[model samples]
Target chain A: MLPFARVTVIGLGLIGSSILRATRSAMPTVRLTGYDVDPEVRGIADRIGLADDIADSAGAAVIDADLVILCVPVGAMGAVAAALADDLPADAIVSDVGGSKESVIAALRSALPEATIVPGHPVAGTEFSGPEAGFATLFRGRWCILTPDDATPEAATVRVRDFWEKLGANVETMTARHHDLVLAVTSHVPHLIAYSIVGTASDLEDVTQSEVIKYSAGGFRDFTRIAASDPTMWRDVFLNNREAVLEILQRLTEDVTMLQRAIRWGDGDALLDLFTRTRAIRRSIVEQGQDDAAPDFGRAHE
Target chain B: MLPFARVTVIGLGLIGSSILRATRSAMPTVRLTGYDVDPEVRGIADRIGLADDIADSAGAAVIDADLVILCVPVGAMGAVAAALADDLPADAIVSDVGGSKESVIAALRSALPEATIVPGHPVAGTEFSGPEAGFATLFRGRWCILTPDDATPEAATVRVRDFWEKLGANVETMTARHHDLVLAVTSHVPHLIAYSIVGTASDLEDVTQSEVIKYSAGGFRDFTRIAASDPTMWRDVFLNNREAVLEILQRLTEDVTMLQRAIRWGDGDALLDLFTRTRAIRRSIVEQGQDDAAPDFGRAHE
Candidate 1:
């Protein structure tokens, strides 16, 4: 149904390895190859049979592959692209799984001069990373956002869309800038807010600090999960997607300040109104199935 | 190990019913009586045998209660206290399970002029509500802050402390004002922020809104659970504990704003530093066994 006969996924981190596993399972006839700059990750993938074969280098992995996916951190896209630029098959479709699209496109395009690159982001992930953290169902019911700048060909874009669609992702296209902006509001800013709040609580004196942890199930524990995401990858995300995250953060800050004043001034109406208004949004999310009616956390046993 | 002959629990909500269930199992010899304004809640408690006996009215329940715990919302504390005020035995010690201690203390003090009143708060709960939402283990290994103002006699305070200790809650004491302020920072502000963000995400246009829910696992869903809390109860919390909530909320807003600016300016160092600093708090929480180290969420089957 699709043109990709030999697909090579580089960087067997959560996203890369997941794509490799899913593609392998769904497109059984197509040959799948994998590579990770980290030898240990490649070894693990080989041992688990996540790929048909594991390659030693990026160039070797993509040499004859018809589809090449850059699944490494957003910051590493450029170097990986450059390393494989010379050996990629002429019509190979190059795509990625980066959170921030603008920087990813800029970096990858500069290195791979002739590939049919369809810049995309699967708005799906877990807090865990590396090959073992991935499973085939990771992409089920998630969104795969395609950011096809002017350089991407229509045919290649369609093919990329089809690939993700078959993978069970609801695919949509938007400009790179808008993707970053919306995500800044929906994901990045929220994450930064979580990190900041957790940091603030951590700064409390030792005795109070221990109590905060002891009673975290009250609310603070939720923030800690987001704050505990892979530090290096998150650090790179903030660095690359700074502008959009900052903009949303600014608006959130102002809103929070207004709330702070209301609390300080003992304004019950303001507090109740906001709390009530926010509860409605949660109801909407539940109606949409984004959240389970059961407890939203501690799903490890599943 | 505790001295109470009969313990009456008023308003069998999540916390109240939990206290009764825990007490029933811990002090099998002590008579546990329960009363709730909600007929269904009372029915559930009766069916579950959470108490030795059930009463239709607060006064009827408190008549012989050596220990009476008012577990209604902070706003309703006054009315509940007043209703049972004249009936409380002279030697009866009254307490409460309100999130905001100051308001609960002020209400009960004015109502029961002849009874010994000592205010307390158990800093633990689940997102679920009603009698069905409680368990004996809810208070196990949790902290219970006992705010016995200067008027409470040492002997009375010690008895109250012993009761909580026997129920498996680690007990500590703080002034009513201090307890309210500390909880406002560690719990209330975080909840408000979660609700606000979830609300904002809900307000997004239809297309973007669907994506918000679909990809909610990124970070937004955590806020949804916190926001999904009992609306009326939360509304009361913000209303009754307005002062301290507002104060801590003010500090949080400032912190969120600073982070926003860092993102806007593409300040990687700022983002990285904040992210790294926040990781320590999570580590502390994990070390304290307040949270788990696994992918703390997404384990739906459990």
Candidate 2:
């Protein structure tokens, strides 16, 4: 049986639009509705027939949805949830696709206290945003983390889990607090470092911007891809997951300082030791099927 | 006419084997020879027929070559060059594929004063190393920067440039000092940061290594791909390009500090501005053909 007969997705950006497409492809009989804060996105969704119905307003979209997912940024989850609170079906299960779980769970629960809230984060995305950048296969073989507290109903969590599994995600259950910390190290801090390094490269007086762009294949190109992620979404992630991100950043900075001192003192062994250890982690990641085993992350060469 | 009819590669690693393969494909009639200090690598290269002849020693490899490209780590370039100095052909042009040019040029010139020295760095590589991991297309459409000082012969410089072009690389000339500085920003520091972050992630007491590997798709996988690079090569790069790399690291640290404060104070505006600016740089890199326009760097998903 399908997890939800009527599903509504708010915020028709990459993740939300991808959900619509994936749901349609996987369970065609299920009804779908979509809405976006941006009118232009809504118009595009309508033109492309992204859903069974393109709701003009948030309230209209979730009026009858058995499952209403807040696909908006973490900071905007409260406002988006509150907008549809009165219109949402009495038996609906509310979920979200936020990078950080604690803040989202808090915001979502506060907005809809009577709702069955089961927050999730699908650990998948590209460097692109907007409705047109998503595809049905985006979630295939990726992890979808469900951060449901003890108070959450078992049936509600199971339905949410099944829905993500139908969309080709490997679902795992965890606490909201742990999810935030794990994601902080794995996603948020990595992105912050990428953005900081890219900015550092661009601001250099010694190196021309053209030179940086031309020679990016050396390694800088990888940072640019992550840094190119949606600004508003990432800003919300940092703001909401502040403590965890700051703690991870502090750890990263200490490591960087140690390496910096090693470089200054010409300590080749210390550098090599760390470099060697990191290589093993890459192997573990590839072996776990989290990434491809192809060289250079399987970057296409033309 | 080919740039060099008889070319010897003195290091049967990724870059050397790739040069041999690309040379065989592009100029089938040219004679190629290869050598490595490790007998096991030599045995593998011989078993795979990586070159027409796998010399037993570095001195034997360059005996009759018109051009010899040293593909050893920067730290070993001096020793490799010294080993071949007496056996090198009187008119042979010596070159290298080192990440940093200045130290390599100095080492080669000091070791073989009378030899025609032209150092080049192909701004291309995958995390995989060794002869068997290489492919002929690694250098296709990639930039090869040649560092030939004023004292180097014009004929020698042109011949080296033409050789790289025949191997499907776009060649450019620059001073060795400037090349070191630019690469310090683009390649060296990026690698250092990647290594540092990966090290930090692995060392976290609260997060298990398995957790880091499983959730790597969140963004940590990108850094791992770079941190998995050859330790010896990267060690040599950091040690030899000390000044420039340290300078860039200092700049990157300052930028990270600024962003840290922004996140701590909940300054979303500052964070958004930097994230937005970085996206433009990614677009520029893609437009300039330095990286593919495909989302997520066109990483193979399966």
User: lDDT of each model, Cα atoms only?
Assistant: 0.79, 0.92
TM-score of chain A of 2: 0.98
Write one digit per residue (lDDT tens) for candidate 1, span B1-302.
56688999999988898898788878888999999998888888899888988898989999998999989888898999999887888889998888888887878888876778889988887666788877777777778899997799988889999999888888889888888877876788788888777656655452266667666756777777787676667767877788777666656666766766666676778777877777777778767656666663644411
Per-residue C-alpha lDDT of model 2 across residues B31-54, encoded as one tens digit per residue: 999999999999999999989999
Candidate 2 local distance difference test against the native? 0.92
**Residues A66-120 of candidate 2: C-alpha lDDT, one tens digit per residue:** 9998899899999999999889888999999999888888888888999999999
Q: Weakest 10 consecutive residues, lDDT, candidate 1 chain B?
A: B293-302
Q: Give the TM-score of candidate 2.
A: 0.99
Candidate 1: C-alpha lDDT: 0.79
Model 1, A1-302: lDDT tens digits are 86688899998988888898788767788899999998888889999998989999999999989889998878889998999988998978999988899999999879987778999888767667789988776777677889997888898999999999877777889999988877776677678778888877766552277667776767888888788777767877887888777666656656666766665666667767766676565666667655566543532211
Native contacts retained by candidate 2: 0.79
Enumerate residue pairs that collide in model 2.
none
